[model samples]
Target chain A: MNWTLLLEQTLNGFQFGILLFLLAAGLTLIFGIMDLINLAHGSLYMMGAYFAATLTKWTGSFLLGAILAIPACMAFGMIVEMIAIRTLYTRNHLDQVLATFGLILFFNEFVRLIWGPIGLDIPLPEVLNGSVELFLGIRYPAFRLVIIAVGILVAFLLYLLVSRTKLGMLIRAGASNRQMISALGVNINFLYTIVFGLGAALAGLAGLMAGPIMTVEIGMGEGILIITLVVIVIGGVGSIKGAFVAALLVGLIDTLGRSFLPDILGLFFSNDVADTAAPAISSMLIYLLMALILAIKPQGLFPPRGA
Target chain B: MKGTPRIIFIVILMLGLGVVPLLADYFDEPFYTVMFSRMLILSIGAVSLNLILGFGGMVSFGHAVYLGIGSYMVGIGTMHAVEDGIEWMANGFLQITLAIVFSALTGLVIGAISLRTRGVYFIMITLAFSQMLYFVAVGNERYGGDDGLSLYMRSDFNGLIDITYDNSLYYLNFVILLLSLYLSHRLINSRFGMVIRGAKSNEQRMRAIGFPVFRYQLVAFVIAGTICGIAGVLSANQTEFVNPSVMHWTRSGDLIIMTVLGGLGTLFGPVIGAVAFLFLEEFLSGITEYWQLYFGPMLVLVVIFARGGIDGMLVGLDKWWSRNSTVKNEEID
Candidate 1:
């Protein structure tokens, strides 16, 4: 519990929080605009990681691989929307859930077939392979710092695109009223496809960022997908600002809780009790937060105005 | 006109299931019996889920947690009996009671919290709670942690019904399945069932009409979880092992698929769906290890093209045949 250690953990949490925000922003946008639940969004994340891994190896450059993988994931997302997701818009939520659940299964197996059962490891570039001295003898991984910076830049760009651009105007209109916008001559379906692709690209970006730190493997999407879902729920579904705030909160709480809870519990409980209970409790921390939040504010902390 | 075809189909299915044990013995292939027993156990779980999802209009994504709880009750009880010499812990009746109680309590807490939200929120909340339990199970080292625990012995009922034997266990599963189907039929057609169904169709309207909709839904959720717990007990016995894998969120998805494939809101649909799904899994895996590649797309197609599932299709066929016969009568006239 030294100052440097605490500072380092806080930075780690912030870095992790950025990753969650990247996934959540796209998900919230898609949910807001189309009113569709895409459970397979995580598959896109997994695909991005795999694509980045392959592209990186082939090109021998992490930046180029990521640049290529984003569009690839976007195209894949649009294709999925046209084929499977288009019909689900009018269907009930349950059907949408089941269909997306199927897509998850399909994507995982497809990845396994293509990538093999073994996980692919993405090696960081030489420039980011070392640690950076922040200040006062405290150092942080340079790669993680890059992730935070990229995440913040992306978040800023997303805000501009959603609020300042014509497409963003249409997106806002669609979220508020789909038929009204369609009646006004906007190609809502095409717009949906683009928005869906954009969401996929964002998820892909998250996967690409995560690749160097984590293994790129089949079913990687599902593990993070659930957490993303939790983030959306906590953030008040379909609210980007809510998503951003909630994602960071959940990340910091999860990371910090896991790191410090056991030691804190040891002060009161026996060593064995603290050791056994900490992991279980820490793993449950965010979910418990979600439950408490939902109980108190059923519409979530920052539900969309008028919703 | 009286749903004669559906009744006949049910009769045939029941009789076929009834003779599985005897047929397995005659063919000297006990594997079919074991597999069918597993199917029946899962069918029970699916049926419980249908009570909430199909009829009650509550899509609980964590229904399988009760199954895990049910399995662990027996698993941990067996561990205590063997290792700590607690003979009473091995009693099948007590194990089942504890499992039912724990499952009911969990369902109550989950339902109370999740039922407050509607649609996608409910789904995500339920999933989160189950994932919470899953992580807890993965972290508990005393109960074998991530690796799960092996039940050294099945719970003994002391001759009330010896489940150690395959045939007896199979019969027990059959009887329970029959009883559950009967219970579901009675419950769904009752006044209470009407309230739950009404709420599913239109919750606001139900509430406006002075019905305590939340209470009814919570009751249904608890009942469903408890029944799934019974299935869990049988599942643990049948598999002779319990692990964290049983509680995985994917397993809950499997339960949803089975319920939907059989025919949502239909009493006997879960059984049919379970049997068909398990058989399909076995058949596909026999052909290739990467069966999910085929299976996943098939599910997507079912959602897109075939909404009613197997039972719905069967009912549709019967309607078509009866309509054609009436057409012939009109021509003759």
Candidate 2:
């Protein structure tokens, strides 16, 4: 067993987990507070990446492009909310799912229309392009490390906003009983939009970060969106803390399972059998984990209070 | 009087589908026969899905997984027959039976766990399970894996009917569609179906009234999956190939669209919805390369404005027709 390889994969898993958390946090927040299932959340992530890629090209600086893309994504999300999602709040989950499915189709085609069939590439700035040594003889990409750092910083800031602020109190109240909050003369509609925007911004950040790593393309959000949804479901639909924990768990399990399952299977079985089964089993690992979790604790690892 | 338009619409749709092959021959346009065959096969899937989604209110977003399963059964069966010299594996009846059994078992496992969760959780869980199956299919290298297996020949029904002929295949799909419709009609009105529908409207009330809602839902889920497997078999034959992409979540979304576009909780709506939805898709794609841009927003508008869909529109037309006839009769009297 190579310790360095294991260590490197673990760091990769952690980085991937952080990215999942960024997407899951906003998804959980919007779902928790608004009682809305926004399948188009992933589309916002795609938009963020597109915004960053295009803006970076214009500004000639990755930092400024990323900073500007957040607001652009927020504004796009708010517009979508006001026009399309607001009508869905009063409807059933099936309706929400179908309507948002439509939004996904629209967004994918919309991207294709504007950006053409090909994907856009976000170039890493010179400062973040190279690898840096972390410990003795171990080096990692500076950009990935930056993603981990930014994700942690954002998660910490989010924790403060949710736990230590008045708006956070209102958000908590809204999640528990939006009727009471509205009855208390709070502008619940405004709050809903703000939370939605905040969620969108978070998704945008995750997307922009993903751009340099993955191709900025149409339908890119969907593959990751499924993973994010799995993370949120495993964590507990409306719990931020749950999302964080579950994201890391899923990321590690998926990454590690793919890398190591074949070797482990080889010890017990023929090389041919192990090679054939590992990819299938490893790919199924997360979903199998999800099913097991749902079986044991259907409400997820951390059910929100009063949910 | 209210049912008049819907009845008329169903009759016309059935008649139209029944003659699709003959019409195709008359016009010398073989494409319509092929297109409608695909539509009818998928309508079977949509109708099966409507049983669980529309009546039972269990949104199994991974419904397409069964289609892939059914396809694989035929695809793998034929592959074994040809390569491994297992000739009996190519029998259509045996292949269909295996597809049903496998999909039913898959549905049972998926439903038992997913039905434990309600609402959006159910949706997400089902989606995840289907994805699991999709990945499994992709990883299976022996049966062409990700590229999928191409059938050298369609399923042999022991010379009962030759599906090699386009018309024969079309009629086969048509007969199956009617059988499924009949099955749905019987199942929906049956006592068991009442339990499923009742549970959908109000699960707690049904539970309080002594109905085991979860069991009823699970049964319906399995039944729907089995019927969809049949569709998959036909699909594999029609296209001569089966791939993992058939089980993709987007394909499931397409099924949901067909069901909803036709109308929910209606006997003939899904069939009608299949025709309308496919026609619109065919029509729109004919006009532009980016049909989804238009189609996506159109779907949103349908959900927003046309609550009941095309079937609902027919019902409204029926009401208006009856009202005008009644006024004329009153004046005559």
Candidate 3:
């Protein structure tokens, strides 16, 4: 009911949106560049969190744990690509889906075996654990702010990498036309492995950052996986810029809708009914947004050229 | 036309299924009935998937959503019949008819939007929509929310047929399954089936030949949904419970697996697949808690070595055996 509370919630939603971008960016890149539907990408995110949690426990430093987990995830990604993913490149989408889905099941059970079913807590470093005062008397978690800052910084770096770097050029070219890139004398197979590995690392970074705020559990990856799919679908698959915009939009709509929908509906319905209806409607907000976007633009907002 | 082999195979499979209770007298009747009913339900689901996936070449990851919708229809109808004294129609037959219609309508709307895209986008979109429906069902408190709803009694058959008894329910499911198989067989051999198959084989050629591929695919999708809807009705009666889990993406994956493992693009592949899959689950789960560790690798091996599936493998073996027998006879002569 309070305006400031509503404002704070919107900011919270934006922060969540930025986090989604970090995950979706990597997913869209791999999906776009390789034309592979990697359902196991979310597993990478889950692995990142678990790795960070265990490392943080060992090293007694959040920053050092995150730094170590990034490369570890990259290495893990390369191993997966070599052992399982390379064979999938020649198979049809259905096989890829089935194989990756099997990977998801395996990874979830693997995590359960290693970490047990109990949710693990990853505490923020003592220095950044408290709340920070922002605007007029509004305060938010300092860690969340840090997440937003990192998200934006990553986004900027991604732009520079995709738009300015040689790897980015190959990635863009590969996404636009894989056959042509291969014919142009590039080692398409190695490029695909590197892209897949980078994608995993990015997902790992998102998971590492998300550990403090969300419950780090075995199935945490599945829920966010669905949302990341929605982001890519709406933003247009294979476009980093599209993912960045769509992620923020989805994050805001989901957060703000959950916060304000009950109050908005209270004008017509009783409080009890409103409360029950609000959450369901709010959860559906992103899907409804997706449907509307598809209806208007079936190819998404910014499909990669020639895609 | 060579129809004898297929007809003989179907008869043998049916006889085998029918004699299950009689042949295994030691097995509990209720257990056989439950397993048979589940097979029937899942076969209906897999067959519907084949309509689109095999014939239409649309690999939908959200096909289970129809089953969910069908189940919800029964749940909601029963809830209204119990609470509001509102009859869905005049009788049990009409109520089931309404359920099929409702499920088909949902399929139509979802398909109309989803069939616009191809490949991975199509799969993801269908999955996203189903997940959307799942969350909605989970949030609805009146219907028991996450715990799901229980039916107070089996749906009334208006004195035409009694479903409350186990034997009666088993026979009902059996009759329905046979009818579905027959109908699916006929549909797959018809002119419409030819168009759908053509689309599956080569959409570009179908389009080049002036066929509107999307419309045909959409229609196939709706028919598939309606068939699965019937299965949903039977499932509710068998279990006397309905939940959002019916529409979960994993269930969709299971349906796809059933179709592929039995044999894609074949008339009875789904039925074979469903039976094999459920039996495997029952047998494997008995051995260890980590059954999936074994099961997952098996699936990968099947995809790798037996890409054509069990049915395909059987056919290959038969061909090789017949050739060997002919060679042996010539040497004896």
Candidate 4:
């Protein structure tokens, strides 16, 4: 393998992992704090991409589009939470699944109605469009580097918020024992609204950032959402740290396997056979990893301590 | 009046279904005959899924995989016979038995692995496994890839009814649906089903009582998967096509919706649910292409407001009617 190509792929994997972290973080938090499974989380991401695409088109500024989408997602999330998801707290996971599933259909069709099915594309800004020379031999896109920087900064902020703030303590407490948190006179409903909105904003951020790289379209969130679910399963349910570690690991494995598995298989099989078989195996790789992980640790790698 | 009203209602419903195809023939609307045939086939699927989801409390989000595998069995079998001149694969009984058996084996393996995980993990893992198969289906260039292959004619049953004829397949599907419903009804009431139901109600308790909960659950899971695999044969035969979309996660979701909408754990609920849900789809899509928007919220309403679903509602109405009559009996006495 060419060293430069390997490094570039690694960076690409890292960038992808970062986006996953953004999406999975919210999902884990919602699951952790609310004990709710929100299948519509991906719909939030889809709406964010659509909102960002629309805003950027109108404003002619990518950064502004992304910035505006965060709050927009939060507002929309709060509305949805009140209208549909709030009542699901008392019901079983099956009900939550169906209700949110309904939300998915509604949102997908609603987007189709507004966007007219033909997908939108976001162009990278001119300044970040150029390639940056990292060293004498390697070059990478400036936009990707910016994404890395943003992802890390967001990660840092999330760490600080979760670790240092009083609100974070409340969130942590709420996650473990909602009854105790409510006994302490916390408005559990308000807290849930905040948490749901926070998760939605995080997903929206991921979506807005992803728009320029991938097509902004209906049902786009679903493809990545399953991967995110695997990340959570690998990382351990309701653990942000696990989500982070798992996302990166999944991204690296997926990326590297896609690039090199065929090459490795070529050593044993014919080139034609290797070409055909590699992709199918690589596509199954993450799920296999998740299954293996679950078989060993059904609760996941880093399940939140003490419930 | 002495017996439960829901049973009375079910008898009426089945009788109604039995006669409708006959009525359709007389009315010259083979269209509705075909429609009810499709519903019956789907009801078989929904009913099988209900065995697991409603009765056994295993929320298998990937149930449609069985349907797709069943479809592909017939699709690929016919393709082999017609295109490659492979005679053995084209035998309908062999194809169906292999499909059901293969899907049951897969169900066993999948059940063995997935049953270890509970709640949300089970749901996600099942969805993931099904999706994994879906992608494989998408990538297989031999079987038409993303665009599905078609069966020129329905599977043949030698020296029996000609299923390729329009209403023959419909009647056959009705018989199969009736058989499946009867089998499921018996299975649910059998001692084995009692163990499964006991486990579903309280696994810890079931384990304490020395029930091999996992084995029972796995068996139930396999049975449900096999039944769904049979339904998949009907679906393939009904549509005369097989594609990855049949196994799509959304289709699995649709199965769940039908089960829930009908009433979990109650006999005949899923069939009604399938009819209501599919008929609504047919009606709404005819009115506007954006039918899903209405469908999505309507599902939400059913989940939110009608937790008992159509079957549960009927049961509740029966109870109310019985209570009113009992009061009259007291007054007369």
Candidate 5:
């Protein structure tokens, strides 16, 4: 394999992983702190993309549209929480699953009603449309570079928010002992809404950034949500650090595996056979990795304390 | 639980289904017969799902994998039975036998790995496995690949039963549905049913009482898969086609909806759920282009308010009616 191609794929994987990290962070936090599984989280991500596409078209400023989607998503998430998610907290996981499933059905059709079944487009700003030289002989798309840089920045800021802030402490405490924190007179319901809102915003942010690169479509969020779930499962649910590492690992493996598995398989199989089988096998690499990890460490690579 | 109301309900439902074809003939709307037949086929799927999800407390999200596998068996088996270059490999009987048996075997393998995890992990793992199978189906170029495989002719029973006709196929589905419902009913009341329920309610207690919980759960999983595989055979016969989309996890989600909407842990719950769920889809799609917009929110309200589903709500109504009648009698006295 060419070294330059390898380097480019590595960067692609990094960018993809960062987007996953954004999705996983929110999912893990909501799951971690609230002990609730929110399948509708992907719908929030889809909403963000739709919002960005719509606002950008209306205002003719991509940046302006992206900025406005955060609050819109947060507000949307909280309203949803108040209306439906609030009822799920006291119920069992099965009930949570079914209810959120209903929400998914609702949002999918709701988006269809507004945006129609076709995908929307987010026109990239001229400034971020070109490629940038990453190495002497290699170039990378400027927008993808921006995504990686922004992802790193978000990761850094998130690290600070969780480690050094009082809200972080409350979040950590809530994840650990919900009853204790509630008994201590902290407004648990408000905290939950805030956390859910924050999670929605992160998912939204990921959506907006991803819209330019990927087709901003009806089921786009769901396609990525499965991979994000794998990331969190590998990283250990409720642990941001775990989510980050696992996201990166999954991203790298998925990208690299797709690119290289066929060539590797070619050594043992005929070209026709390799070409046919490689795509299926490589696509399954992450799941196989998950099964392996689960077999050895059923709790995952980095389960949260007490989880 | 008292059986009178349930018995009355069953009698009415069976009668409704039995006369649907005659009614359709009178109205000259044969489409309703096909629709009811589809509902019966799906009811079998929902019932099988309920066995594991409700009674066994194993919320497998990939139950449709078996359905897909079963359909593929029909497609591939029929292809082989023909005078193809590949040689006539097997009879339709053997193919179907393999479908049901193979699905049970697959359940055992998948259950062995997945049942080790619980809650969300189990859900995700099952989903992942189903997707893996979906991709596999998508990759098989010989079987039509991404486009899916179409059957040349329906599975021939060698004149034992004529399944080429829609009405005949509908009757087959009806008979199978009744047999499965009866089988599950027997299972639910048996000692095995109690153990499964006991494990669901309290796994640790079941284990503490010297029950090999995992083995029992795995067997239940296998049984569910087998029944669903049978449903798949009916579905393939009904549709005259088999595609990779058959195993999509969303369809699995629909199966779960049937179980939950009908009533969890109840014998007749999933059948009611399938009917309600399908009937609503039929009604809404008839009225609006964006039916899911209405249907989705309605499902949410059901989960929120009718938490016990249509089956539970009906039972509650029965109890309420009996209590009110007794109170009236007391007042008169």
Candidate 6:
């Protein structure tokens, strides 16, 4: 195994993990604060990517497209909450699952109708397209570095927003005890909508950044959605910090496992068998990790005290 | 007025299903066999889901995993049997039995772990486990991976039953469906079913009454998984293939839709649901390429307008019809 290849895979894992953090952060917040199970959260991610792709084509600026898409996704998310999800907040989890599942079907089909079934590509801006030299003569794409920088920047901003503001305090209060927040006259409805919109924006940001690296398509949101769920599960469902750490951990383990497991296994098994088994085993690593985490701490690593 | 009318309605419905093939034959059509066979297989799956979701109050979002496991069992068993030319030990019945047992074991393990949490946690955990299975299926190349596994021939029934012919298969499925319906009815009314239902109504109350609610739910989950496994086996045989798609979250969603569309907590709800759902799917798909454009909105409408589902609507209609007739009868008397 080449050291350079290993290093590159490690970076790739970190990048993937950061993207997962963006998605999971929003999901956990909405779930914790609103007590809503929005399975269609993935649809918001899909919409963001699609919106960015379309806007970039029209405006000829990737940055502007992303800027426009974030607000669009937030608006869409708020509308969905008001029209459908608001009623569901008072219902049981089963109703939430069923209704949101319907939303998924609707959104997937709607995207297909509008964008067609084929995938679209979002080219990286020319200024950020080239590779930058890293350690040991290894070159990495500048675009990927930008993605990492953006992820960190967002994480910092999120940290400030959640820890510093009065809204943040309310959010924390709401997540811990919904009744108490309402009793305190927090405009719980407006708070839920804002939280939902914020969650959608985060998911949208993940989608916009992911569009350049991964294929942009109607069903793209679903693959990431599952991983984000895994991240949230491992991270303790209500904590942004936990989501960040778990996302990075999951990303690194998954990427490195897939990249190196076969090579390692080749020492004991035939190349063909090793190749076949590696992928399956690697895909299962995160789940095994999740199970291990839950086994150790059933409430999750950073479960909110009241939760 | 009570049992007789219900029995008559059921008998008429069954007879109507039984005579469909004859009616189709008269019209020189052969599609009824396929439709009925599909209905029978899906009904088995829906009924299995109803046992847990309706009676036990465990809304598993990954119930389709059992179907995948059951189908894969058939594919793997047949692959080995053909390679070794094993006759006495490995056959269709044995394969199906193994599939049911394996799926039940999986259910037991998953239920044990997931049942530790309640509500949203249970849904998410079950979904996560199924997703893991899906990923494993997609990545494992030996089992055909993403392209899925195809059988060279349908499973042999060893002359104990001939399922090669469409009509024979239809009849066989009918027999199994009827048996399942009967078994489910019996199971629901049993003392065990009572405990499960009571647990669903108020778990805390049941616990206060000294019932071990978790064990009862786990048992229900296992039984439900095993029944769905049988459906999966039949599905694989019908399609002559098995794939990871069987365990997809969408498939599980479909099962939930069928259960809700029929009527929650009703023994025969899932059966009606499966039949109506598949029929609607077939009809709608024929009308447009994007049939779900209509189907999705319709589901939303159903949730908004008819929360109790089509069965509930029918019961309401029955009540209205009876009340109106009673007034007229009183005037005549």
What TM-score would each prediction reach against the true structure? 0.98, 0.98, 0.94, 0.97, 0.97, 0.95
lDDT of 5 by residue, B50-143 (tens): 9999899898989999999888888887676664733333345665688899899889888989999888888878888888888888878878
lDDT by residue (tens digit), candidate 1, B200-238: 889999999999998999999999999999999999999
What is the iRMS for every candidate structure?
0.8, 0.8, 1.4, 0.9, 1.2, 1.5
Which residue ranges in model 4 land beyond 4 Å of their true spot? B1-5, B331-333
By summed lDDT, the worst window of 10 consecutive residues in model 2 chain A runs over A86-95
lDDT of 2 by residue, A1-307 (tens): 9888898889888989999999999999999988888888999999999999999999999999999999999999899889988888888888888899999999999999999989999999999999999899799999999999999999999999999999999999999999999999999989999999999999999999999999999999999999999999999999999999999999899989989999999999999999999999999999999999999999999999998
Give candidate 2 regions above 4 Å deviation. Answer: B1-3
- Candidate 6: segments with Cα more than 4 A from true spot: A267-272, B1-12, B81-84, B87-90, B329-333
Q: Cα RMSD (Å) between model 6 and the true structure?
A: 2.2
Comparing 1 and 4 by lDDT, which wins?
Answer: 1
In model 2 chain B, which range of ten residues has the least summed lDDT?
B1-10
TM-score of 1: 0.98
lDDT of 4 by residue, A1-307 (tens): 7889889999998998998999999999999988888889899999999999999988899988888888999999999999889999888999999999999999999999989999999877899889899998588989888888898899899999988998899999998899999999999999999999999998988898888888999899988888998898889889999999999999898888889889999999999989877877888888888888988888889989876
Alpha-carbon deviation at B103 in model 2, angstroms = 0.9
> Which digits, one per residue and each the tens of the lDDT, describe model 1 over residues A64-157?
9989999999998899999889998888888888899989988988988888999999988899989999987788999999999999999999
Question: In candidate 4, what are the lDDT values of residues B108-164, reduced to their tens digit?
Answer: 988999999999989988988898888888878789778999887778777487887
Query: Global CA lDDT of candidate 2, please?
Result: 0.93
Backbone clash pairs for candidate 5 read: none
Q: Which of 1 and 4 is the better model by TM-score?
A: 1
Per-prediction TM-score, chain B alone: 0.97, 0.98, 0.92, 0.96, 0.95, 0.95
Q: In model 3, where do residues sit more than 4 Å from their true spots?
A: A268-273, B1-12, B23-26, B80-92
> Candidate 6 clashing pairs?
none
Could you give the C-alpha RMSD of every candidate to the true structure, in order shown? 1.1, 1.2, 2.5, 1.5, 1.7, 2.2
For each candidate, the alpha-carbon lDDT, in order, equals: 0.92, 0.93, 0.84, 0.89, 0.87, 0.85
